[model samples]
Target: MDEIKFICECCGKEHESWPAITYNSPSSYSNLSDQEKEEIAVIDSDFCVIKHSDQVDRFIRCVLIQKVNDHCEDLEYGFWVSLSEQSFENYLENFDNENHETQYFGWLSNYIPQYQFTNSIPTTVVTKNGNERPEIFPHQDFDHPFVKDYYNGITKEEAEKRIKKILKN
Candidate 1:
């Protein structure tokens, strides 16, 4: 397969090649009951809904491996945002139509603290919403001082230290 290269708008670096995956079929989300949906309904895209929870710990570990192995290249601040169940459904219903120029809102399902970047960073993704390739934006609030600082930049050593701490605890 030919490598896809592009200058990333997020990090301002050339992406030699990277795999972009999109899940259009909401089979996983659709299978959940209303109660489960309520339990996991992400209200804020800026921060992790599961932060400080065991789930976050596990997620961080998995993300670390993925960053080290899959996204080893110059990552746009090290993490990418995903859409929440409700937000994704809304996007599919509204934007996957004839109109392809408008922007849609979605919640972040994945958050990496070690990445030191919040939701403010926007990027385009190919979605099922019309074959025209509608872009989905992840809205994040950077009101918190810490959130802003994370986006500033973290040294690789600091990131590794944080990851070790998360793993050790």
Candidate 2:
């Protein structure tokens, strides 16, 4: 396979290597209307919040690494998840704390292509004691094919194919 590259919009730098997929926002945010997004949603590279008349949906950016069967490179995803207000606040408060460590229950907010479901999936978002983004793990008992593939892994050819398809010319 050829090298995959993407220009980082966040840092305005070139990224030679790449994750299999990276989503800019949660599907919920994407579903909002233009005026709704401007009036009710606050989003950045790491966090997002959508305010509804009766509820506030909070989200955070996270990474999920998927093992590709018989492949040297794993399939990684930069996805989003909905968090409770408390969890979102805590994460935001400790954003600059390199030693902060915690965990939160979240709902997978991105409708990944292969794992598209009617409802958001349950997950555990783990914050590490460093600069790295939080990692999410799907609930093992969740009856979803995506969760199964996440644990069992995908074929190398499938992984490469997905990447090539995503980063099209």
Worst 10 residues of 2 by lDDT: 11-20
lDDT of 1 at 56: 26
Task: Estimate every model's Cα lDDT from 0 to 1.
Answer: 0.38, 0.87
TM-score of each: 0.30, 0.87
Supply candidate 2's per-residue lDDT for 46. Answer: 96
Model 1, range 10-97, lDDT digits (tens) per residue?
Answer: 6688865533322222222334467754676333222223322343211100011123222334222223344545544555465536
lDDT of 2 at 72: 51
TM-score of 2: 0.87
Question: In every candidate, how many clashes are there?
Answer: 2, 0
Error of model 2, residue 169, in angstroms = 9.5
- 32-122 in candidate 2: lDDT tens per residue? 9999999999999999999999999999999999887774557889999999889999999998899988899999999866556977789
Give the Å shift of residue 6 in candidate 1: 8.5
